[model samples]
Structure formats: C-alpha cells, structure tokens
Target: MMNDVVLKVEGITKTFPGVKALDDVSFDIRSGEVHALVGENGAGKSTLMKVLAGLHTPDGGEINYQGASTHVAGPLDARRKGILLIHQELSLSPELSVAENIYLGAWPTNRFGVLKKRELRRNATRALEALGCGFGPDARVGTLSVAMQQMVEIARAEAFKANVVIFDEPTASLTDTEKDQLFHTIRGLKARGVGIVYISHKMNEIFDITDRITVLRDGQVQGTVETANTDLNQVTRMMIGRTLDTYFIRAKAEFGAEVLRVEELSRSGLFRNVGFSVREGEVLGLYGLVGAGRSEVVETVFGVRKADSGKIYWKGGEIALPRPRQSIDMGMALVPESRKEQGLVLMMGGRENTSLPHLGLFSSVSLMNRPKELAVFEKYRSVLSIKTTGPDQAVSQLSGGNQQKFVLAKWLCADPKLIILDEPTRGIDVGSKSAIHELIADLAEQGLAVIVISSEMPEVLGVSHRVLAMSEGAIVAEFEGDAMTEENLIDAVSHHRGNVAA
Candidate 1:
C-alpha cells in the first residue's frame, strides 16, 4: 500500500435544515488503499460521501487533495480532479444506450461541439470488456438486469480512471459471483494506487476488500482501525454504539399445515419445472444467484407473472391465481425485491404508503376516516422502529432500512396468512437487518407461512427451516438442518441438475 494521502477531510461538518449530517469528521484516504466507511442508516455515511463527491457543500471543513487544499465546486469539478462517486441508488437513464450512459455528460466532441459517436462506442466497448461484461456498447440499459446495470456504473468509473473512487454500496445489487468480480476489480484499482472508499453494511465484504475500516456513528467519527486489527463485532459495535447480537437467528419452529404448494411450474425462458411448498410457521428459503429465477418463481406464485404451465395448491386445494389481487384476497402478500420500485411508492408519505393498499379499511362510502389511518400508521411505526421525522416525511427521503420497514408495515397491516419476502434485508444496515430477522422469527412464531427469497447464503441458511436451491431456471437441490451450509448450497446450485424434488 502507498503512504501518500490522496484525499483528506479535516474538521468537516455538514448540516441540513433540521439535521447535522456530519460533525467534525476527520478522515483521510491514501493512494492504493481501500478504506471502508461503515455505519447504520442515517448515521452520516452518505452525507460524508456527498461532501467528498461535491454533491453537498460542507458547512465547514478543509478538503485536501494531492497535498493541496481546495474546495470541490461541484460533481463535475470533483470528477475532473479524479474523484468519482457511484451512488447507491442508480442515477442512470434507462432509455439511453450503455455507451451513451458511459459518456453521458462528458461526451467526446470537437471544438465545434459536434458529438463523436464512433469514439464513444469504441471506448465503451473497451471499458465493458475490461469490466468483464458480456453486453455490447449499443445495448439499451433498460434491457439489462440490475447486476448488469451495476457493472455498467462500475465501468463508467473505470473509464474515468479516477484517483479516489467512492463506492456507495456498490455490491448491494450484485450476486456472490458478481461481487467476487467487483472485488477483483477493486484489487486492481488498489494496485494502481487509486484510493477507494467502500461503504457497505455487509461486514464480510468490508473485511475481505478493505485495508482500513472507519466507523461513523451519529454524524461523527467513532474510530478508524486497521483491517487486520479489528473484527466484525467491533466495527458493528462502533456503528450502532451497542453490543449487537448475532446477525441471523431463527427459533426452532413447529410447522403447521401446508400453506402454498407449486408443482411443475414453468415459465418458458425464465424458469421451468419449479416446485416447492411452504407450511404455516415455516420459512422456506428460496436460495439462488442472480438470474437463477428465484424472483421469477415467486412472482408467478403471487400472480405477478403468468406461468406457462404449473399446478398451484393453496391450503390443500388447487387454485388458479389470475391476478395479484386474487392472491392478496386469499391472504397472500409479496414484498418485492426492489422496494422503491414495487414494494412502495417513493413519492408518497410513510403513513399513506402503509395504509394505501387497505384504504378500504378506513373508508366508508368514499369517505376516509383520517384518525383511523393515523392510528394504524402509528402502531406499525412504533413496532418497526422506523426512523422518520414524522408520518409526513416522504418515503423517498427515508433511508433504505427505514423504507424497507415501511414496506413490512404495509403488508403486516394486511395481516396476510402467507408472506413472500424477496431479499428482505438487501441494501439495509446491520442493526436494521437484525430487527427484520427478529421480526421474521416473530412472524413464524405467530404461525404465518413465510417464503423468503435471498441471494445471501448465510441469511438463507439462518432464517429457514428448509431451503430450495434453484439453478438454470429449475429446482436443483433441497437443503435443511445439517445439510444447510454455504458449501453444500453452492454445490447444489452449481452442480446438481434435473432434480425438482421438494
């Protein structure tokens, strides 16, 4: 690792109208180092990254770059100085081609201001190849999967050849294989003396990729420790200011009667011959890598997607789910993977989102009972420990963890019999992850049939009584208890074939 400090923030403080996002934050990143920034949601990690990226102007601070102190004027200026920020929420234009998105504002042009399309395509292809992407430059971004889109964003950073790259939850959308690819890319960057600031809630990634770890809590710096000198527990304690319990814990469950059973489900190009069953008081973990068709199977089960041919049985009777509403009316709730996209409306307030699906509960002849809605929102707000200024705070403004809690609140209000949680804890912090896990256990104890689809191996094994591994759009292996392990699950998903037995 290099000793030269590439970027330094001294006594930095940033404040919003009602919040001091960062306070006297002193941090430095050295060339050829992967420095980690870890904290709970709303703990000021994003705010600090924003200041560094020139997205937010610090109220007070000194920013030093390359042994010279200077103010970052804006995002463009920061990038020109070899600083780049890959935001957690994608900011790409879905309609644009991958090449156009890569060179978006920095389009190659002559002094006459004419666009250079050929150069853009060529460079984008080279960058995409460098990032190990299979897609070509002309491919429409909207047509790409979430993992591919994330790779495009990384490719943009690589093309920029930035000196100090700030990665905000870069691997949140990637699968284990994709994450390994990104780690490889990161190591390459580090070897080139490019400083990286990695922000993620997943401690395994932090320990595996970073050289130094910095913990931020309550808008201030807790401490920065050498990676070799610390462990997950210590870093987490610094983040939440408490001794956190185990990451995932599920109580021994006595499963009730079968709630959902799908037999020989097929969806042509997406998934085929998928079969599974979920029983009351049991968590059936659907484990797979990205594109392994876990979400597709659940989507079909919820009537979100039509299956080519399949038999679905609900409570021992074969049933046809023609629409989502039919499944909902039968006490089924699906917590989609993209919470912002499908779980909840971002522009709506928390209270409205929580009660939006069941407004009929508080409506009488086209008249909504306002106080009844308020009470319902309050009950879940307290129960889920959702952090918000008030019920009126827009869901778009809330952190990922809190927004996910609201999604949970929305479905919990429905009091469904069977819950399909897709990536329940994706893109959330450790503390919030623990809370959601506890809530899952509580739901199972209360006898709600839970089907959890997750790409995280530890989570699938920890939360479920049994797991069904999917590969190449089909059920490959079944794991439970003693057989439920990362190694075995990996082997099952990668090696097993033609075994749709449940």
Candidate 2:
C-alpha cells in the first residue's frame, strides 16, 4: 500500500495559549501505510501526534520528510530521522533490565573501555528475538506486565529503526489475547516498509488494524477513508462529527429492597469467590479484560482492598468494612479509574475538587465551611450538569468530558448508597458520553446502588442491568436481557472461564 507518499502534512498550524491545537492540517503518510488516527476526545489526535513527534512546534505549516523539508527538533530529532513516538504512557525504565532497557544509552563499550556485558546480553537477545518479543533479556522491567510493558515499548521502537511509527493508544492497555499480540507486531511493521501511525479509541480496533483512515474533528482535517473502503458506521461518522447515539436509554427503573450483599467475597490474590447482590434499582455490569480482576473486584467492594475473606451484607445486617473510613461510613462511593489519578484536584477548585471527599461533612469545629462549601458546590454543580467556568474553575480547566463530570459531582456529593463506577466513561466525549449515560440512568432512577466497572463493550451493553463476566481472577459469565450482544459481550469479555453461576 505504498504509492510512495512517505509523509507530507502541509498547512499544519497548531496553537495553545487559548487552544487552536492544529487546524488547516493537511495530510499524507503513505509509504507502507497503516495510518488510522481517528479522533474525538479533545480531538487534536494528541495534538497532531505532538506535531509529528517533535513534541510540538508547528505554529504553522509544512513537514514533508524523505522527499525533503523537515525539522522535527526533539525526540532526538525524531530519533535521527526514523521517527518513533509510541505513547499512551509506556516508556519503560521501570528500574531497567530487559537488557538494561534495551541497550539504554548505547551500552556496548569494551576494547579496554568497560560496560559491554557480554555484548550487551548478546544484542539484547537479538533485539528481542527479532520482534517476536517474548521478554527475558534479564527480565525485570518492573517485573513486566502492562502487556509486558507494551512489548518493551515495541522492543524500543524496533531498536530505533522506526520508519515513521507513532502508535499512541496502543491497544489502550491491551488484552484480547494481548490484542492478538499487538496484531502480530503490527504485521511485522507492515512487512518492514514501516510508516504506521495508529492512535485509537478502538472501533473494533479501527476496523481491525487500519490501512487508511484519518478523521480528526475540531482542530481540523476530517476525512481520509480507505480502510477497505471504510465502515464502523463511517469511522463513527468521521469521528463524532455527528450521527452519534449508540443506544443507552435505561431510565424507568425504581426498585429499593436489598441495598447491598455479598457472602463469599475473599480477596486473597485479588478477587476470589466473590458473591453479589445489589438492589435499590440496580445496574452492576463489571465485565473485564485488561487484567481481568475488574479493579480488584471493586476495590474489594469499596473497602479499597484488603479482604482475604468475606461477608459484607448491608441492608440485611452484617457490614464489616476494614477501611476507606469504613467505606465512607458505609454509604460507599468509589468512581475511581484514575480520573486525574483517582479522580480530580488538579491544583483544586471545581468547587474545591468537588468538596474534596466530603471534607468531613464540611467540618466546623476544625474550620472549613466557606459558605458551606459554596452551597455544596452549587448543589452538585447543578446536579452534575457541571460545565463549569465558575465554581472557581481550575479542575485543570475542565473537559475530558468535564473532568468526568467533576468526577460525577464528586460521588454525587457523597450521598452514596453504593456506587463504585471505575472506568465510568474513560477519556470522555460522545457528548460527555451521553451525559455520563444519562447520569447513570438518573442514578438508577433515584435508588442508587450502581457498581459498573467497564471496558466499554458498548459501555457494558449500554449501562448494564446485569453483566458480570471477568476472567482469570474469577467470576466468568452472566449477561442479561437478550444476552447483551456486541458479539456476546466481546465473547463474554475475551473468553470466560470459572466461577460464574449468578
């Protein structure tokens, strides 16, 4: 697929002091293409891949390459012109090894000089067995596993011989068999012609590993087509330029009885023999894949880890929480999936990080009461309608879907009954993920109890009613209502296994 364009990118643009983040951005990238880019979350596709990997400079146009005209000033001048990138956070150096982080700082020294450790462990085990990358070049990249530190950052961008690589969202924390082993190392870097570029949000992995498709919405260029003549509803209507709505109604729920329950919950090696039962109008979901422990079974049902054995029943007696301030004095509310590292505060103020973990119920004898925390942040920022420019702003200048609706108005103003959430719409935007799935179906029609934990199988079959799934760390399959489709819930979250009988 190389009609020889190699790379163009004219009219580039970029800007920041008030956000323009690329406009007039023309495109090209051909030589051995894989392309794919797409967009939506602050759509500048990581600021035009950080201005084509020079880490931002383009305040205007031009960037040809191989056909001439270039100036990638940073990442070691685009790694001496071969161009690398690969981020979605995985750069390695987790206390080195894996052949000293694959010949880090160009090792091989000797000739009466020193540091050559047997030819740097035989050329880092022949560049990780020529990219089959099974690890063990003296191991320990912090005992590897965020998919083996993203295959040692793709064997250090195939030992820096990258012919314009890029990647970015690299299977957003892999695991559909490690995303088919990263599509066999991106089809061996497109049979060695290399020009990749990938960035994703997983439209079935950009229609199963792109060939050509470009999208990018606000901040320009929105069309490139050709991934086998496109589809995934036209690359999601050219990445959210419209025709959106992927169904998620769920509103009429209204139950109330059993607010919570669990029996054999054990958290030994993280999630085991877990039991369930939540009512007050349920949702539940859970499902798995990225380390199939589903955030250690809801942080051990909200006591934030530490269980080793179980019991938990809330409405019908028992309650024994070992921490998280007795699971927030037992109203229990989590929502964590690193929303700005475990949910907000970016130097504070979207109403003081939404009343910072219920500031001890707005303390009085020990101070804190600024007009009752600004009238409890204007009443949950007008009950999670939070667009904010005022509750004193700065929740890091908002938007990643209003910083996840100010972390869902800080656990719905900590008036929890049992929420949990984790991955509650990661990296937000389809109109703030349909307004946080209609505020979790209006907080389960005002009864609360939620749970959630997702990996987006159509948002756990549209805000789940009863999904479950998980794998390896236990609980295998459950689904409900016309068997939650998306190919049977992504094959019950990538191949189910044991304990599921609920």
Candidate 3:
C-alpha cells in the first residue's frame, strides 16, 4: 500500500497568527484513486491542500512524494514534481485566449525566445479534444461560460502531465449536465493513473465520484474510509460531528397576509412572465437549474433590474418603478449571490460594512454618529454570531462562513421588512449552512417575509413553505404540502409544460 501511495502527508500541522489551521493531519493519496477531502468551511481543508500544493509551509510535519521526503517551496516547485491544484475560484486569465491561458506559465518558445503561437494552439487543442471539450482553443477565456472555463483548467492539468491533481469545489458553479461531463473527465484521468484530491461539501458528489473519503474536523483528521463502505449519514456525522437529523430544524410558521406580489414579471430574454408572491412569515423558495433566471427575477423584484412588463404590489398598493435606493427605502433588502463583489466591501472593516446601509440612521446633517454606528455593528455582531477579532477587522480575513455572516449582519442591521437571499449558503460549510437555515426559519417565525433562491435540492425542500420551479425564464410549476417532492421539482424545472397559478 505504501508503495502504491503517490503522495503522503504525515503530521501536517500549520498555524496562522491566532489559529491552528491544520493540526497533526495526515493522509495518503495513491495513483489512479480519487480521494475526497471534506470538512466544514474552516476545518483546515484548504490549508492542508495549500500545504500539499506548496502555497503554504507546514509548521510541523513531513511530506513524502514517491516514498522520498520532499519540501515544496512554491507552486512552481510543486508543479515541477507533477502536482496541480484546480482552485474553487478558478485562476484563469480572463483576458487571454483559451490556448494562451492553458499554456500560460510554460509557453512553447523558439530558439530566439519568440513565442510559438501555432505550437501552443496545437497543444491546447489536443488537450481540449482529449477531454471532449466543445469550445474552440482560440476562444477568449472570458467569453466562455464558467463550465467551459473549468474544462480549460482541466485541459491545462492534463497537458502538464501531472500525476497528482486536486479539484477544490469544482462543481460549485456547474449545472447538472456539466457535472456529469466533469465526472467523465475525472474518470478518464483516473484510468490513466492520475491521483485526484476532491474537496466539496456536496454530499451526493462525494458519494458518486470519490473512491475514498477523508474527513477533517477542527484541523485534525477525523477518519478516512472507503466510499463504498459508508453512507451519507455516516459521512455527515464525521464531517460535523453530528447526525443529519439534528442539523436543520425547520419551523412550521403560519403565514399572514401577502406582503409582496408580482404579476407577470418579465425581463425580455432573461426571464418571462415570472409571477410569485411572498406572505408575511413565509419562506418562498425559487428552485431551478443554472440559467433558469432565478437570480434575474429576484433582481427585478429588488429593483436591481427593471422589469420589461410587470406589476408589483406591496401590501395593497401598486408601487412605481422603484430604483435600488427607493426599494431599500421601502423596507426591502437583497443579499445578492456574489457577496464579495456586490454585498460587502472587503477593504472596509466589518463595522463599516455592517453599518453601510444604515448610515443615514446614524448621521445628522451629513455627519456620522460614531457611537450609534458602533452600537449597530455590535448588535448584529452578537446577533449573527460573526466570528471576528474585533469590529474593525477586515472582512476579507475571515473564513467563507464568517464572511457570509458579516454579509447577513449588514442586511439585518438595515431592518428590512422583506429579505431576498440568492444562494445565501452557496460556498459556506455545513455548520454555517445549518445556522443560516435556522436563522431563516427563526426570522420567518418572527413574522418577516423571506424568499430563498437556491439550486440545492435539499435546501429548497427543507426550508421552503412553498416551492416554485423555474425553467427557461418562466415559472413552470408550483408545489406545496405533499407535492413538494424532489421528483416533482426536478420534473417541473426540466420541462416547460406545467404552469401553476400565481
């Protein structure tokens, strides 16, 4: 077994200024096997991967490559030893062509150092064709969709002749079809004896593709077991140290009168005739595949995008075309999908970011009230359980879950009557997801209307009082009570026949 191991990490312990990222963690990756590295958002999964990829140095431990002790000085050093990491946030050069990006750091050159564009394109095309990628090699990387760009990343890995390849949350941005394609490519790699280290929170994906599962908790190795021998419930227990039954506790809240209603909301090519309503104390779930216009419809309602033809009524009166400021002034809040780019200013301190929406509340005649702002920040920091050294700390320094909490705190401080969250728990860990789901349920119980837009089936089924399925920019079907099964939802989203009354 040791001889079969391509990479071995022994007692890998890495520490930051105030946190022990990876504590005495060890694992072995063998050729032709897919090893899944799983844990909560801050459980040192990324840290350990960085250590293996030479992005970070272990404070204590040893890494043995091919049964020999080794020290990876940097990414280039790791790559020199046939190790490649495909990050969750893709690292492609957007401005460059597909072929150029694939052969970026190691371009083919001539004797006089002139770039060999023809040879580079040829190699890139060969790599893409090997992976069955449909996009042309000369296409601009930025012009391609997220899934296609990911294919380019994989093609680059294959072109490098890497023995060990790590995929970090590869399917986070992909559709069901794209995921299938990715799995097929992974199988091809495995057949050729390329070791894979997959890191993801999606339970179904781990069970489907991974051969072995290694769980980490609190920076320590919890356990490693063959995927065929374990189930989701067991793996979930290992991941968060608890059973699945105890995770999300949904409350059955009685909804009050309709607070917001939309009649035939359309956004031209984006979404069409999308109609829905949210009642006080109700959680309305919008479910669909990628490009189903779920985000677009919500953006229209939130005034980020103007609807082509639609009528929106708040309570009983029809509202005019409300701009973003007007919508916010009318007690509406939207926690957009891309939190870092749209929700929070990463350079600003948590206190400043949290109080951004409510600055007018703490200002008199264009003068900011420091004490009042601090009070608002402190209130949400406590209520949302934001993990930060202080309110003045940069939000970017926090983990994914903590950053999401900070985003929620920012909106909660605004005291909105209706809250629309688009993929609220997209990249967060299981524990943070549980907390957010519970928070949503609690908010609904407290008489706040909530709309949750999510692609995850379990999340939509668990948290929603009513589920609306979207397909091809239209509301295909609506489900409630016993009809809100995953089968029904999938059928509705996949087909365009059923149309339920708004």
RMSD of 2: 21.1
How far does residue 175 in candidate 3 sit from its true spot (Å)? Answer: 0.6
Winner on lDDT (1 vs 2): 1
Q: What TM-score should be assigned to candidate 3? A: 0.95
Per-residue accuracy of model 3 over 314-353 as CA lDDT, tens digit each: 9878998688888888889899998988999998889899
RMSD per candidate (Å) reads 2.6, 21.1, 2.3
Estimate every model's Cα lDDT from 0 to 1: 0.89, 0.77, 0.88
Ranking of models by TM-score:
3, 1, 2
lDDT of 2 by residue, 317-363 (tens): 88776578788777888878888877887878788887888888888
Best by TM-score: 3
Per-prediction TM-score, please? 0.92, 0.34, 0.95
Q: Residue 423 error for model 3, in Å?
A: 1.0
